[model samples]
Target: MYGDWSDAPRSLATLGYEPPIPGLIGSSQAMMEVYNLTRRVAGSNASVLLLGETGVGKEMIASAVHRLSQRAAGPFVKVNCGALSESLLESELFGHMRGAFTGAVSNRTGRFEAAHGGSIFLDEINSTSLHLQVKLLRVLQEREFERVGDTQTIRVDTRVVAASNRDLMDEVEAERFREDLYWRLNVVPIRIPPLRERREDIPELVAHFLNVYSETNERHVVHIQREAMEALQDHDWPGNVRELQNYVERAVVLAESDELTVDLLPPEIRSGTKRPPLGMSAQAFDLDTLTQEVVQQGLNEADPDAEDLHSRVVNRVEKELIAQVMQACSGVQTKAATRLGINRNTLHKKLKEYDLDS
Candidate 1:
């Protein structure tokens, strides 16, 4: 059994790395509000629930909060609730004593216990089963728990921070999540805007990713072409920053020169003329030109890639874009077909055509 937790508050200044509190990458008011909320709630113990689409950087915000909090000196544990099964997740969070189950051979300290005097980040908390949620609720309420197959109670003083990419309210309404638990976890809700909603931030995020990856890859790519920037800012980034990061990394690796031109962008993005109608202006269209410009700008410091590798990369980009559009439409054959600008019957044939739907 663990001893009682000390309630003394620690000073944030003692922590070496101050919270790199996410700032407004854009001047947009929505992003500014998000930054302000993150800064304001950084020092609190209240459970924070980050709501956003995938790749919006909820985990980054969570880390910033932990770094700024009074418990900065202690462990910052993270668990992906959606990644584990119910039984495994229970043991992972609350732990199990030796011989607690068939696979349990020794005593274990779960995320909660490991996070004592610190913070535990529960990613995709909505994925937890009701039974597991009850246990979690108990821990949140009592700050105490017992290992599986052990009656001895263990007390912890871990601050909880949970995040989800799904619509939690919709989940609750569908009986897929516990309402009470949702309320408890939502003490300080932080909503991250999707990339499409904050398209203005594309330039800044692009610059940041470019600089980081270029140095890491020993490249000196310094500029972006105007048409390339336009393509980047115009496309609806359904995958958000993550997609952008992948593009930059790929660009750095395959860059023929020190510039990041649109040619480095995936085929779907480069083929701006083929982009599905997003209710945007057609005057901005010029996929190939944009690609050439951006690729030229970022290839200055990057190594040249062989023709075969470049061809393979183009194919990979095509595959990924197709997959993303299908997923965004939730595997709905017709909608996905429409999004991809193909006939429904052709999409049905393509499902088997690409061996994807199977």
Candidate 2:
């Protein structure tokens, strides 16, 4: 955990490395790889498919690609495909004629037309129905599409960058997404790593968010307490950077002093409690059997004359619980912590004490 502002680098530039994308902050190797890929593909006209879990900054990457591309000076239009119905999305993408269906008040230009000579970021493209996918495929291949009610074709010099939180190939296989459209949008696929995969970047992210929220909320919470930083770093962050950003904003708004203390953090973060561990149906996950093993180990290792015998048994029970959750999560610490309903920092400490870190 970062002990002070002096110990944390706010951005890649602060560490003497120029940021590949101006606004991106992380300097971790995982993000470095993503930066490299983004830089390489930004100049090309090929469609980019950003693959990642939700809140992993796919829109940022998409924006970076457009800004770094030849279409920087042109209009940059964005549309969320999953947010609209098939008919509505069709009219949204390709302009609809007046009275196209019923709500077409006037001849309004669509996203592709508005994005002429620029780029269009289609987010949540996987949510598009198969019917809409066919039209999208046409626009990608022909660079032309007709409005919802108009028959005349409209051509545009626009680039497409699509994003999805789900595995598009899985959708393709399941017949939820068109295979042809999948190949079209997947000309360059970039998989954004989740926050848990890049723990080293947490301090920088926390620092950045602290500065942002402090200024926005008129708070002076500049310094982060050591314990608070540790809790932030140890979190599983299943919701990724967006989640971290929200938490930091909350802390800044609630801070009593200039420092962000552990008490300012949410209860689940400080206590490491999420929910009870899920007991998968497997022989090795038999709680009774595991409890017996843990109790036996406790009996052999504990002091014979110790007055805290009950505490020792309780400790053994906790160890067994942690071990079982770890097994159920395939030894993934973040997932195990979440399943065990404990803070990851607490889980890590318990694992080390019980010699279950492996």
Compose the digit string of candidate 2's lDDT tens values, residues 299-340: 888999998988988888897788767776656677677677
lDDT of each: 0.78, 0.86
Give the worst 10-residue stretch by lDDT in candidate 2. 274-283
Candidate 1 structure lDDT: 0.78
Residue 231 Cα positional deviation in candidate 1, in Å, after optimal superposition: 0.9
Candidate 1 lDDT tens digits, 153-259: 99999899899987677677557788888888888999998888888788888888888899999998888988788888888777788888898889888888988
Give per-residue lDDT, candidate 2, residue 3: 29
Cα lDDT, model 1, residue 72: 87
Q: Indicate which candidate wins on TM-score.
A: 2
What TM-score quantifies how close candidate 1 is to the native fold?
Answer: 0.71
lDDT of 1 at 41: 88
Instruction: Note the residue pairs that clash in candidate 2.
Output: 272-342, 272-343, 273-341, 273-342, 273-343, 274-341, 275-341
